[model samples]
Target: MEPSSSPPAITEPAAAGSGEPLAHRRLVFGIVAIALLMASIDQTIVATALNAIRGDLKAELTWSGWTITVYALGQIIVMPLAGRLGDQFGRKKIFLGAAALFTVASLCCSLADNIYLLVVFRAFQAIGGGAFMPTATGIVAEQFGRDRDRAIGMFTSIFPIGGIIGPIIGGIIVTYWSWREIFVVNIPIGLLLIVLGLRFIPSSVPKATSRIDGTGAFLLAVTMLFGMYGISSLGSAGAEPTDPLFIVAMLIALVLGFLFVRHANRYATPFIPISLLRGRGFGAMNTINFLFGAAMLGFGALVPLYAESRYGIPPLQAGTLLTARAVGMICVAGLAVFALRRTGYRAPMIGGFVLVAGGMTLMSLAPHGLTPYAWLAMAAGITGIGMGLSIPASNNASLQLAPDQISAIAGLRGMFRQSGGIVAVSVTTAILNHATDAGTTQAHSFVVFAAILLLMIPITFLVPDHRGTW
Candidate 1:
């Protein structure tokens, strides 16, 4: 196929409100919100409990790390597909299916006898989890027509709540009960969402019918696999960057990545739209978001482990470290979300990154005069404030450039950050496997991450600088 000047049109259903009452629409929104919160919590909840899982399963650092890696991998891959599937089929059917799938997968996860089993089950859980957003977004978009932006914003805000509460809840479960209790807790909640959804979710007709780009999906998958494996191998103690195996793995990833890009640019309906990647203003936002994902979401995943490993803090306490960050994030993110239309994208984002970088630098340092817990909490809070300030703008920056393709833009933006996260955690775990002092190594890694965040500041100038109050 020849390359096109623009991406294939995203299949946007008519923006019709089906005469649903405002109270009714909110009920539907709440049902989906519960599932979203469940999925969101699952993302970070495991971080606090991971060490316990590893010790119980007797898994290696790199292998156990795949626990986080696999979930992200599944989500990035499934998101675009889910969006199209929801539009092709009915959103109601897709929403209920995803919820049921997540519930069943949670049960399977709770029963896993080993880390390998858990990873496999976790991938299925991720597929269900990944489907929730696009399908739910479709449901909400139809529910509130002119007010969709506000509804969506309100919906999106639920994510940080999950981030804030996930670790603390996980910490509590693991502290009071077995780590399996984390999964056990989901079973009841998931069931409730499914029943509530069936009773309340409006039935929307399939808006479009189309096929997914199998070739593009395949190439993207293999490319990430090769890159992840190469990094994992090279991070070993005796393995040099020049190692033949590492070089081969990376080369394969590069070649495959090139093919994936070509397919994306040229295909009629590529798995990932080329326009989203190369569109004006898109390049800057995607790049900065990738770095943001690596610095905040990716490194943030390891904070509990870092606390437990470096400071010899207990699981319950280490878990609170993330809570501290979330506390800061919630405090600022709510304000930033409301402020974005007034301040423009640049202010909150630049300020957020500065706080993030400074906070991370503080975390890397010793307690100095304060207790390790107090010192780390203060640093984490500082970092959280940075995240809170920036995240809302980071989310909205590119969307303004191409509002029609909201689903595609949102999926791709998430994919970049998640892709960055997969690589970061993969490499970090690989290095930790060989480190003589895991804590010191992890601390030093944060410093390096902070330095990298500093370099990202100048690029924000390229990001969309206008306020959205227009």
Candidate 2:
């Protein structure tokens, strides 16, 4: 594959105001942040409302889990496509279209009377939500060229902000209203984003002239769908790792994945540019990002259930506990931006993983009897702080390393993170399903999460601490 003579350059739009660049940048940030928050919050908010959805829809417990699975599937499948599309079309156009789709989908989700219908609507929602993150990141990269680290840090921080708040907000809404309210809430947020985004978001010229690799895209989608679905299935009750369906899905994923890679290497412009992965810095950052995703998202799924079962707390109370984790992330992110300027990336990256490992270990060792709520909150807070530090550091490193491929790399990074979340959910669910006792299951899962995080500490050493030239 030959490189195009003219690759897309990330450029800033003309200022609309009285030469106030800061104000213009802030407007751009606000537009992207709102889109990012809407997308990120939807990822976890549904977890708290799953039971309510199941009961109201009269859906089987086993099948109802597809609500989350399908939404994730949409995200995994569309992220790369969204990035490529934004590059081929205009980022502003793609962002607005996606945001509109997400808003309409949310309305449809609230009206769905059956679980299957709700799941379908959720996928549409995911399509819009997934596109928002990478595209928004791309905008930040262009708008804050020299200060991309600080801007990226602020943008990346919204992910945990939404993650921390989703369940709490979901719980409150569910407690006061109906489960459908969860979807209903997104309607206003999404609509407002669409209106504001069209007015304020800057337009960019399409960068790519190459035709998309349809075959490569299809093959890659097949690999992710089968692989993720198979892994998630393993978490079901009485599920066997050796189940025929699981084995078949895994086999198919492997074969299709190989085909996709081969096709990508040959195609002029593949769905995902495989060359990006060859870079040591980009590759290493993605690997650590994957681990972070698994630990953070996986533990997030387990905590509410763990809290509810261990303490006999109501769903609302259990969800509220997640606020501690959010608070930790917010606080660390602010400090990390300053710390990175003074210390560079290596210290925070290593220290962040250490904190994550320690927190998970603490959670695993919680007393078998009724664990104190304060103890749970503290452990979660520690883990959140670690996540807040590491994720942005890694993301900033990736952006700095591959400034030319901002949207594409951002999408790729998202794919890795979401994939980790999928795997984590699957692995933990399987452990929980197989264990006879709840406490033991939770401990085993935490240990597994901690072990994965510990691997990141060594890997972080491999990441080049390229402090941006201020």
Candidate 3:
């Protein structure tokens, strides 16, 4: 990671006195937004088609879940390394490389004749996809150092905005074409990003000298996998947490994982520098983010399931409901810069969570046989506001706290956020599995989302209200 005293300069020139700085900045944001959109869309492209994937692949429900799990796992495994790679090599090289890999993998995914091949390609796609989120963020930090808060507001909006629209777009592709078309859709977008990225993304060199921590990286990966497995297991009582055999295995993994983190802090050049964790503001923000991540991730997946399974809605309709969330995100995202200017981040942060909690509560009351369109639209939009505010605030806080090491701070935030998603999905899946009879899974899912939303309130206060360069 580069030192705070001197970070990478934005290589792309402003559309010189185009008499519109906002428009020029928006162009850059547009490019980053599109890259993020590609990645976000892929997460759920296979979502509406989960059943089709299961039927075509002849896999059981458990294995079908891996289509999503493997991709997230791949992302978790690669996320930390991306920051280091971006810093050491250059953001443009890593960004373009990841984009290219993601593009090719998408093509492979479309053509896979079997589930095994599809899963493999998905993992490959994730490795590539993982590079994108962090790199795009690092670019924002690099380019918008002067306007840190607004930069984060814009940067954070990209994914949720993408996520909001992805399901709708994905549904269209699946409905009009086939499930495989979801993967195929990325080809043109990916190609364009690669071209745009090369022209715009600046090259950078790391200011700090440190060796890659292969040992620590390996251990962190193991720890996350084990932790995720434990989380996945907790999703069901039938999947006993203390089965002697599973407990023993988990213990071993936990022990090694702990040792790995410790070792990394002391010996290895860890993917996340332990030194950064010492920043009280940054650390607290990240902890809060992890909780937020868990809730948001669970809801992200479970919402679609509810619309499809409970309402007997088709894939496209289900997707439209999900797209509403993104629309809310995009709308709130535009407001974020202005909001930050007025509120200094703290008030909006609290308000965002409040909206989320309130929205989730409203969703819990949705009556059966009622058209979910109205409820879903409100819930999705409100949740987007909560998400839009929280993400930008938390991201800016963490990055500012560690201005010298944007890569490392951004990497850690990404890890916590991604891991939160992984755990949330695992737990939600487990809860949905347990709560639902054949008849009421959809309702049960909402109840779970309500519970998660209720849990986010206290955590929101941990964030500080003041604005600084950090």
Candidate 4:
């Protein structure tokens, strides 16, 4: 195929008053980072708190799993919509509104008396948090137009940093206070972001005139929600994969999913542009991202439960143990950037998946017999390193392949990764529910995760070994 023409240069929103002073740019970057950090940390903070929530709410394990599933679903649903909304409205308007919504939702979560209420509120919180991410990315890209590469580097680092610290913070809070504090803590931060954002964040004019693809969005949301619900139901006690309801939901999801693809292809402005997916390297990178997200976040979600169940570790200790993975990710992320510079994208991409697969294999062995805590932590760390290595490389590769559609590509990447998270949490929970033995069930689940990661390794080879810098 002939090389596609370079996309027209992205112009900054005229209303935002580009070419701001250096100090002003730094202030905006800080605001964006703060917003991004809060959203990122929220993703993992609840992983360690699931047990506490279940006990407090008198909820079944399967239902409690919805707390994570619903939040991710909300994110997956809102990411693309949020980007388009931001483009249609204004970044500052959407960011502040989302921040405010998040603050209110956090308060509601803290006050929720039942698991059902908590899940509903958590979804709202996710809407706000999810919308903040892409909009913040846009803000940074616009504010630091020429120097966006450096700005983006700083912006992206917040995710790993937030992930690294989230469990520790959640543990300390849950230990001293209650899990409610986890949501409560966001209130103050969210409010501060709103206040700061109002003062520092510039408003951008609508850059695009495309209509929101409401039908496509609704169809896609139904597809994911039903698909996940069906998968999770398979693991419920007394439930069988062949159950009529489960089969029906899956069928519905499949049908809607097919319709969504057809709709996207025909729509003038799709939530996920079909052309981007058709690009040479873009689809492969996203596939790797999807699998990587499933393995990485799925394992992270289950580890605390594994530790608590096997070792009778307290929530605080379990949370601390979870940090080993983050340590690996944070430590390796910088090194991965350098490694990418030396070996190009292919080595890091393939090597990262290999490490993750290896780590999952080690983790799967834990259920059969006694394994040292240090050994488990080492495995977690290795998985984290793999995540640190591969994620950036894949992201860089996607940009290299579709630099013209960077915004759309980034949105799709987030959507696919969160979609993986939804599947991982649901499937792992289902496996645990159906198994008679916790150890064996978890072991089996890790093995499945390992297999998924292993499959991603070869797919990474399909990505062009692009040596160019972003």
The candidate that wins on lDDT is: 2
User: Arrange candidates by TM-score, highest first: which order?
Assistant: 2, 4, 3, 1
What is every candidate's alpha-carbon RMSD to the true fold?
Answer: 6.9, 5.6, 5.4, 6.2
List ranges where model 4 is wrong by over 4 Å: 1-25, 47-64, 146-150, 153-156, 175-179, 308-315, 338-343, 366-371
Name the weakest run of 10 consecutive residues (lDDT summed) in model 2: 14-23
lDDT per residue for candidate 3 within 70-112, as digits (tens), equals 8887887677778767766566788889999999999999898
Q: Write the per-residue lDDT of candidate 4 for residues 173-209, one digit (tens) a residue.
A: 8889999999999999998998888776766666666
The residue pairs found clashing in candidate 4 are 235-430
TM for every model, in the order presented, reads: 0.83, 0.91, 0.84, 0.85
lDDT of 3 at 264: 62
TM-score of model 3 vs. true structure: 0.84
Model 4 RMSD in angstroms = 6.2
lDDT of each: 0.78, 0.78, 0.69, 0.75
lDDT of 2 by residue, 1-470 (tens): 12222223334443211222333567778888988888888888888788898898899987788888888888987787788778777788889999899999999999999988898899899999889877887776666656766887887578777877787788889889998989998888888888777666667766676776789778877888888888878878888899998999999999988898899999888878887666677678878777877987778778878877666767766776677887888888878885677767878888888898888888777644545677778888898898778766776777667665677778878888888988888877777776778766787788888888888777777777766443
TM-score for candidate 2: 0.91
Q: Which candidate is the best by TM-score?
A: 2
Model 1, span 1-470: residue lDDT tens:
12222322222344452322233566768888898899999988887777899999999876777787678778877776676567666777888999989999999999999999999999999989988887887677666555454456565458778987887788789999988999999999989998877776767667545676779878977887677667656545567667899999999999999999988888887766777777448988889878887788777878888999998999778877877887788777777777776888888888888889999999999888999999999999999889878877777677667654555566667777876776676578767877899999999989878887888888888876876531
Q: Whose lDDT is higher: candidate 3's or candidate 4's?
A: 4
Q: Which model, 1 or 3, shows the larger TM-score?
A: 3
Clashing pairs in 2: none
**Candidate 4 structure lDDT:** 0.75
